[model samples]
Target: MWKIYLLAAISFLNGTSEYVIAGILDKIAEANHISVSSAGQLITVFSVAFGAGTPFLIAMFARMDRKKLLVYALTVFSVINILIAIITGYEMLMSARIISALSAGVMQVTVLTLAAVLAAPGKQGGAIATVIMGQSSALVAGVPIGRVVASHYDWNVIFIGIGAVGLLFSVLTLFAIPKTVAEKPVPLREQFKFFMRPRIAAYLLITFLWLGAYSVVFTYISPYFLDIFGMSNHGVTTALFIFGIASAIGAQLGGFSTDKWGAFRTLTGGMLLHAIALLLFPFIGQFAFLFYVLLIFWALAAWSSGSPIQFQLISLAPAAASIVLSLHSALGQLGMAGGAGIGGIAVKNGLLNYLPWIGAFTLAIAVGVTVLDKVYLNEKQFKETQSTLFIK
Candidate 1:
């Protein structure tokens, strides 16, 4: 359990490094003598690298000892961040971000896989949730903390801090995590075939749509708050804080619910609630209390399904757990990117009020997909059982 918590801490460090750049973009741009839009490309490159590169890395290194790989990845991740802290040129910063993204992607998949394999029976979901909580807590605290550090010192200082902590945790992970049996190296061609199965394919679709629904609204939430509710900067910040806290709590609750209620029920219930929460955003009008309550509930509902979704994917193909998880993680990044892209289109069309509705509609489609997949699976299992009984 303590080992799981330590993994979570490393996740927190990794997540902060991933997200804090968004908060300090202005500072970074000024330091590098680039426009802020160009500065934002650092984030785009990181996401693209993480989403497109991690699965290959995991497959390529499949035969390496899990413990050693994790340690090496963390060491590389730390060293990259430290290098970023000392670098001044835009091109150098972009190059460093790519390396950091790949390392962070590897770290995330390895951490989650380790948690799932190391947990006691029936506790895998809980353990995974604990690791996710680390990421969620970084969202809650990392950006604001980055802002504070940037206000007083250099923005690059945040990376240095993340690098220092990462190194410390690399040592901790080396000492604490026991070595596990290495996965047999799967050919890249064979690994891509995992996506061909119908159920697995459907599950991946749900992963994309579910996170896409959340990101569609969340990516543009500050502007939505300003345009729709006329929230001052302070007010928007306060709302974001609440949303972040709810998301963290929702992640922990998701694990508990998945363990207790089974993955299907938890997933179905969470998605339904998420859709309902978003669908009501426009109808809720100008009631502040109701708005805030709904905001928290929306965050809770949006996040609570993460553990169950991952649990289902792992259950689908335990033999290829790392491959599936890496793919799932990659798809999740794509989903967020897709959502943000779509939301940008809406905002460009002057459709800010409709963001929630678009998100809700996307979630509704995901819910339908989940339900249909469940029915198909149930019928298939029943037929298989009947055939066995008949033969007997």
Candidate 2:
């Protein structure tokens, strides 16, 4: 239990580090004397690094001891956060951000892998969720706390705080996490080979599309509330807090649902709900309560899908769990990269109000893809059943 808490704390630090920037975008821009547009590039850089680095890092470190790798990653993450806090120029800050992102990407995969391995049979969902809840809580609490810190002090304070937390977690991880050697080292080529499967390719596509659509609107949410709804910073924070709370609930619910209904059903239903909520965002704008309600639904449905997706991929490729999970993290980051880019373009091009429309459209595609996946699964199951009956 203490080990679980330690792992979750590490996750919490990673999440706080990843998202603290979002809450302090304006402050960062002002402090650096740069345009908000340019400052937003920090997210772009981080996402790119996370997307491109996770797989490579995992492949390169595959043979290394898990405990050592985790400690190294956490130390690097803490150092990068400290660098970010002290960096003077935008370029330096961006570079540090990328470094931190790489560490975070690696940490997330390692932590999840560790969690799954440590869990008893049939408790993988709960184990994974225990750590992931940290991320969700960061969304719920970290952003608001970051905003407050940025507003009251310097934006750098956010990174400093995150760095301090990372340092603490690093110590905890180093001491608490048991030394576990890899069962068998998977070479980089073998890792890449997993993608050759058609079903694996389809699942990767699903992750990409689903995350892309979700991040599109989520990336721009704070600005959307401020610009369209005329919300104060407090209001924006409040709204995000509400959304995060809902997401945490949704994540818990999702873990339960995955165990009961299976991954495909949970994913399909979650995607459908996400699409519906996004489509309704514009309609609910007139009423604050309605708008918040929709936001809650959106956060719940969208955030709940993550664990099921992870569970499904692991089930699909049990032999290559680490590599497949690495790819999953990379693809999800790619989705975030795509979404943020699209949202930024839309907002810059004076299509801010139409942002939710893009989310809706993208989600519709995701739903279509999910439906296809279901059909594929059902047909495969039926064929297997027929073969069994014939043999009997």
Candidate 3:
């Protein structure tokens, strides 16, 4: 249990590295004398590297001892952050972001797998959820903290602190985690087979679209608040704090709702709420009280879908749980990348106010995909169809 908590702490660090950039997008842009839209590309490239590079990297190192791999990845992640603290060149920063993303992805996946392997029987799900909480906890605490710190001192200080903590956690991981035997590696081809199934592919697609819609608005939220509502730094921090808390609550609700209502029901309803919230954002900016309510609502609705999405994926193909999970992570990040990139394009074209509408449109497509899967491509439906054909 202590070990699981420690792994969660490590995940919190990795998540901070990935997410804190959004909190300080304007600061980084001002420092480099670039447009905020250009700064947003930092997010796009990091997501691309993480989404495109991680699964293969995991597959490449599949047979390595999880304990050792975790420690190594954490060390590399720490060293990269430390370097970023000192390096200021734009190209250099981009290169560092790529390295950081890959290391963070590997560290997260290894920790998740290790958490399950180390937990007692029947407790694996709780253990994995604990680790996920660590990541979600980052949004609640880490981003607001970064925003406050960057307002007070150099933005680089946040990364320096993360690097120091990461190194310390790596040492803790080395001493605390027990040695475990490696399982046989699943081939890339074998994993690809599960993806070929209609239901499996549609679930993954929904993850991409759902998260992509989230990223479209959220990737530029800092500037959006500052520019439109004229929020002070303190106000921005407060809003983000509220948003983060809502996100954490939403994740818990997602898992609960999945258990209570089943995955499809929970997912479709959550996603509908998510899209509606975004679509309403453009119209609510003038009312301060309503504005904040909508922000919290948006965060809650967006994150509430996460657990059910994963639940649906795993339920669809239980034998390939790990593979499906890895694919889910990859697609989720790619969705974020696509969203951020599209938002950047819109921002560059002077369409900042239109971002929420664009995000709503993307989520609308995702909702449709979910409905399509439930009606036409679900496994139960396919099985029934096969039986009917055989009877004829």
Candidate 4:
């Protein structure tokens, strides 16, 4: 349990560095003298590097001690982020972000794998959620804190702060964490076999698109606040803070729901809830009180969607859990890349105000995928939403 907390702490640091930019895109853009869209490419590159690199890194570092590997990965992650803090020039920043992203992916996968392997029987879902809570907690702490820091200091200050926190956690991890018992390595060929399973592939496709949809709206949320609602930094921070709080609460709720209601039910319910929130965003965004109230439910639904989906995949192929999960993490990165790319193109065409609509449309595709799974992969599901939704 304590080991799980350590992993979560490291995750917090990494997640803050990865996600805080969303809240301060305009500040970063102004600081770099670049368009917000160009600054958004930072998300794409980071996602690309992490998504494409993790599996290879896993294979390459297959023999390393898990605990030492954790320390080393975080060290590199911290150092690269520090480089990002001190760097000037878009090219340099890009290089640092990619490097940090790759290291962060390795670190993330390692923690997730360890959590699954190390937890007590039937506690894998909770353990993973606790680990992931680090990232959700980052949402809670990072965005608003980063905004406050940037409002007084500069955008670069946020990176420096994140880098410093990463280092501190790296030290804490080294001392407090025990060496994770290593499992027999599964060969790449054997692991990739999970992809051939229809359920696995379909679930991955669903999450890939689901995350992309969320990113399209999330990536530009700050700029949207500025452009549409005429929000100040404090106002934008307030909205993001509520989102962070909801996301944290949602992560916990998602874990509990996955255990209680089953993954499929939790996932469908979460998606439907979030989609409803998206449908309402356009009507409520300008009225701060209404928007704030809506955002709580929206964020709750948004954050609740993740754990159940991951838990479902793990249940689908328990023997290859680590492999499926690694790919799961990778797909999230892929989704981020896709979302950032598509959103960038959309924003370029001046479609920023339509983000909520875009989210609803994309999430509908996820629901469609879910239905397809119900009809085609019905015998294959693991206490999925289908059983509960249909009153069976």
Q: Largest lDDT belongs to which candidate? A: 3
Candidate 1, run of 10 with poorest lDDT: 35-44
Clashing pairs in 1: none
Estimate TM-scores for all models. Answer: 0.79, 0.89, 0.96, 0.89
For residues 98-145, what per-residue lDDT tens digits would candidate 4 score against the true structure? 998989888887887778777889999889878887876878988888
Candidate 2 Cα lDDT to native? 0.81
Query: Worst lDDT window (10 residues) for model 2?
Result: 182-191
lDDT of each: 0.83, 0.81, 0.90, 0.83
Q: Mind giving the per-residue lDDT tens digits that candidate 2 earns over 1-392?
A: 66876788888878888776766776787889986556667877788899988778877887888888899999899888988888799889888988989999889888887887777799887888788777768888988788777767788878877878788878877888888876565676776787787667778888888888877777766667877788888887888788878988898788899999988889889988898887777776668888888888898899878878888788878977767877887888888878878877887778767778888788788777777767886578669889999999
Residue by residue across 1-392, what tens digits does model 3's lDDT show?
A: 99999999999998889899888898889988888899898899899999989988888998888999999999999999999989978889989999999999999999998999999999998999899889889999999999999999988999999999999999998999987766788888887887778888999999999999999988898998888788888888898899999999898898899999988888889888998998888787678999999998998899999889988888888987888989998999999999999999999999988899999999889989998998777767779889999999
lDDT of 4 at 136: 69
> How do all the candidates rank in terms of lDDT, highest first?
3, 4, 1, 2
Weakest 10 consecutive residues of candidate 3 by summed lDDT? 179-188
Q: Candidate 3: which pairs clash?
A: none
The residue ranges of model 4 lying beyond 4 angstroms of the native Cα positions read: 1-4, 113-128, 175-181, 256-262, 379-392
Clashes of each: 0, 0, 0, 2
Better of 1 and 3 by TM-score: 3
Residue clash pairs of candidate 2: none
- Pairs that collide in candidate 4 are 264-385, 265-385
